[model samples]
Target: MRRVGREEPRAGRAVLPLSLTLVSGILDAVSFLGLGHVFVANMTGNVVVLGMALGGSPDFSTPGCLVALAGFVAGTVVSGRLAGAVPRPPVPALVVESVLLVAATAVAFAGLTPGRRFAAIGLLGLAMGLRTASIRLAGVSDITTTVITSTLAALGARSALAGGDGAGWGRRLGAVLLLLAGAGGGAWLILRWGPGVALVAATGIQAATGGAYAYLSRRRP
Candidate 1:
């Protein structure tokens, strides 16, 4: 299946980006499975779900989908603003992501009852969307946590008949695998540990990543 993650930054390790990818996956899984049948990261799926809901699809929650769509937009906007304002590189980007994720985690944990889908979905979507956007703005290229259409497409083409430099395949594969792991883990957590598990895990990972960045920046700065 064409090994991935070839686009490695000159920095230390790919742990941070890979963690962020998992964050995206977990958020996607929770949003789709536990909170509501919507995707916080994959806006395309969110739109499709929204359309189906509007069309009176069975068991589709219109309110939930609309809420997620709106939250994701808000998150993206917030992330963009943060990236523009914050200094480039170092821990700034991760700082913003960590803050947003922590906030979302609070929301999720506070309302993690069997029926608190609104808070769960809304909070997670807001945080995840913002984190993904932050990754984009930070120039963490080819590590989009949400969707993988272009990445997969490129991987398929480049690793195929074209026979070009496959430097980024490792990173690409890392992103995909991290996401799948997140989704699978999220689904399992939701089914076993409940909705709170997903948000807790996501937030915790982001916070750790942020801390690592901060430490690294200070050491090098």
Candidate 2:
């Protein structure tokens, strides 16, 4: 019974990271497809795109990628400070992220002029950075809530077929699937309605995830 009680809290904690992964996917899709062919959440992709842009690719924007990378870095710095100041780092970090997402959504609704597009990209990149840093501070294992390359690698390397114990396979698989689902849903919504609608949806999911995490933290002993 005691073990079950302990396990329940761990399970509850997993929900927040997984939900954030979905949020990252939606934001990445929206940014890459609608904004300026850059990734806000997945900085790895953003870096590669930036390199491509530097190499004279007309399909990418150098300025947009740079802004996103800078914004993400700034957000991580802010998150580190926030984590040190607050007893519960994730709560405050998530609150800030949610606020930034809301602002990004508002900007998206306003218009996607060249200037506003960069603004939205920077805002999203910053928010994702905050989320990533907070999750790191929380020490959640096997879920990154953003890039899944490492997760995929670990999944393949640790699979029973590879003569290794399938530890963390479930969470890794779920992260991949959720990220895929979020990206697909985000792209569909962008095509059907607009990027603004997609940002609105992403903002709602982010806010809900923050709220759920806060509630769960409060309930945990």
Candidate 3:
């Protein structure tokens, strides 16, 4: 395994990306269901919504989608800078992501009026953007945390039917399942309690994931 400061080889690891994929699903569900039908994690969906809105879809908000896209780009830039500055462990980026999620949770509890709801969406988008960028910088594989289209393609290409040994199936399948689980759980929380509860759960999980990574790094010999 390769090591770089506090960072260890994360490629081919299922646990971290699986957990982060779960986080993505939770945030995306909350963003879509609770925050004006926006998508914070999935920019492709957001862009599609923007196009639809421009094509006269009353169900979508063009401004909201644009705001989310902009926020995501900003978050990516910020995360890139953070990673370059730290260049060792990824704890700083993860902590910043958690902070963004926490802010979103606070916005949810504060009530989603006109401005506040959009603010929450932006925050969620920013957090997800940061996470995706950080993961890419860390050189992980078989998981992008938010996007699964490529992962699905990879799985299909390497399946037994495709004359391949089905390598990396566990991580690929686990990512998809975890994402589904997180989305279901987020939706249930939104229906049973409210957005506040779901956001809090997502934030808590994100923080816990970061802490766990940090702990594991310290234990590495």
Candidate 4:
């Protein structure tokens, strides 16, 4: 476990990445169900939808998928440049993620109606991309927050039932459950209130995650 702020890594102290994962699930759900038939955080789904669009599926849009993929990649590029600029514990990265998520929430509500849905998708995708890239450099294990394919694989491989040591199962299980809970909550919010409320909720959680990290870093040092 890599230290985020010079403190010794403790067991069960995975609130930060779990929160980010929850945000990802929420944003992805909002984007898919509310904004458009597209995924902002889950690029794999976008790729599949893009393929469907190319195959003449009327339900998907090539332009929307392209925008999201481009935005996500661009965010990764931006974060790559900032990776060297930030100090230890990835505080700068968290700041950047928080700001991006807030901006995404604002953009989603800034008249991004059905006509301008692609713009909102791009913004949210960019934020997720930035977050994924920055966190990659953080050296955290079993908390990618963006995708769980690897996490699922790890869980299966490390499970005692699979003839291996049951290490890292807790993180993997927590991530899976958090993502599920987030997606369910986002869907409920979208059905009851609107996408705006879901985005606002995600932004609040992201802000809290960053704030908590900042406080912990300060107290540890």
Candidate 5:
């Protein structure tokens, strides 16, 4: 019974991060496909796009990328501070993220005017930044929620094929698959209904994840 009790909470720790990763994928799809070729969650992609824009690529927007990058930085700073001050950082940080996502969804529903597009990009970027920082503070191993490059590298590096005992491969693989699934589903929804619908779905997921995390945290001993 004691071992089972400890293992259950350990298992529960992965839930919030995985759910947030799915939200990241959906937001990335919406921003890249619907917004002006920008990535709100994936800063690595945003940086590359920013460079391309600087290199005179008409397909990307320098200002939009800059806004997202700036927003992400701001969110990280804010959440880092919040994490330092609070006992349970993920709860409040997730609340802030949810609010930002809701605001972004509203901006999307209104219209994607040039101004509104930038606003949505910044809001989504900020929300994702908060999520990244909060999850880092939560100390969940093997999941980053927003980016999965390292997760993939670690998965391959420590696999049995690499002459090492394969540990954590399942969770790493699941993260990769969920990211792919979220992107594909989000893209399909955007194509069929529009970015507004996809944003709504993402926001709902974030809100629900936050609620679930809070509930589970309370239940944990």
Candidate 6:
């Protein structure tokens, strides 16, 4: 149990959210560059693009991103429904996110010719949103999974006021760094090879995370 004014146990359980954030970054980068300058993982960026599109910006498209956002909402709905039935964050999250990944894998496999940009973008966005909502409901604080601004802000505040102990600053810092790593690597993979490679990598990472959570749950019992 957490005190009203105190931070939760960041050293152990809190690490779970960061892992999902890393997954978010990778998928975001892949969707951004490969999916026609749209974002599946980071809705903030997608919303920004949406606004620009409405403002008649040449670089962004209004309809394309709206589709991604809709898919994301659908994905979130799916995740929320799963949560309602299970009522456990970690296990339910794993189940929902793994299903999203299966959807993503199916899209990737279906679009293996490397040309169905819209299909990939839509599927990727839905998968990411579903996975993100699961993490958000896990009751993590200081990390939003899909959004980095608050995470960075929290890291700064904690690192500065760390005083003597720093109160789990390492984990927060690790979250930021892991997100960067995911984005950078995802971008690199997409640019060098193709969306297929990045999708594969993202799928593998999430699958492993699900496996880890399941293993930990078993051990706890």
lDDT of each: 0.71, 0.86, 0.82, 0.79, 0.86, 0.70
Of 1 and 5, which scores higher on TM-score? 5
TM of each candidate vs. truth: 0.83, 0.94, 0.93, 0.90, 0.94, 0.83
Candidate 5, 53-139: lDDT as tens digits: 999999999999999999999998988888677767788889999999999999999999999999999999899888787777667
Clashing pairs in 3: none
User: On residues 1-221, what C-alpha lDDT tens digit does candidate 6 reach at each position?
Assistant: 11121122333265567777788888888777766677887888899999999998998767669878988898788767765665455565666666766676676666644345666666776776676676566554556677787767667666746544466677677888888999999899888888668877878877787776665655532
Q: lDDT (0-100) at residue 158 of candidate 2?
A: 96
Position 89, candidate 5: lDDT: 78
Clashing residue pairs in candidate 2 (N, C-alpha, C atoms within 3 angstroms): none
Task: Between candidates 2 and 3, name the one with more favorable TM-score.
Answer: 2
Tens-place lDDT per residue, model 2, 1-221, is: 00111222465467987898898889999999999799999999999999999999999999999999999998889888886777677888889999999899999988889999989989998998888877776675457799999999999999999988998888899999999999999999999998889888988988998887777766763
- For model 4, the superposed segments whose C-alpha errors exceed 4 Å read 1-13, 219-221
Each prediction's total of clashing residue pairs, residues at least 3 apart in sequence or on different chains, is: 15, 0, 0, 1, 0, 0
Which scores better on lDDT, 4 or 5? 5
Select the stronger candidate by lDDT from 3 and 6. Answer: 3
* Tens-digit lDDT track of model 1 for 1-221: 21122222445246667777788888888778877688877888888998999998986788888788787788778776765565543255566656666666666667756346676666666766776676666655666767877778877777746787777788888778888899999899989986667778887887887787556545542
Backbone clash pairs in model 5 (N, Cα, C under 3 Å; residues 3+ apart or in different chains), count: 0
Error of 5 at 216 (Å): 0.7
Off by over 4 Å in 1: 1-9, 89-93, 111-116, 219-221
**Positional deviation of 76 in candidate 2, in angstroms?**
0.6
Better of 1 and 3 by lDDT: 3
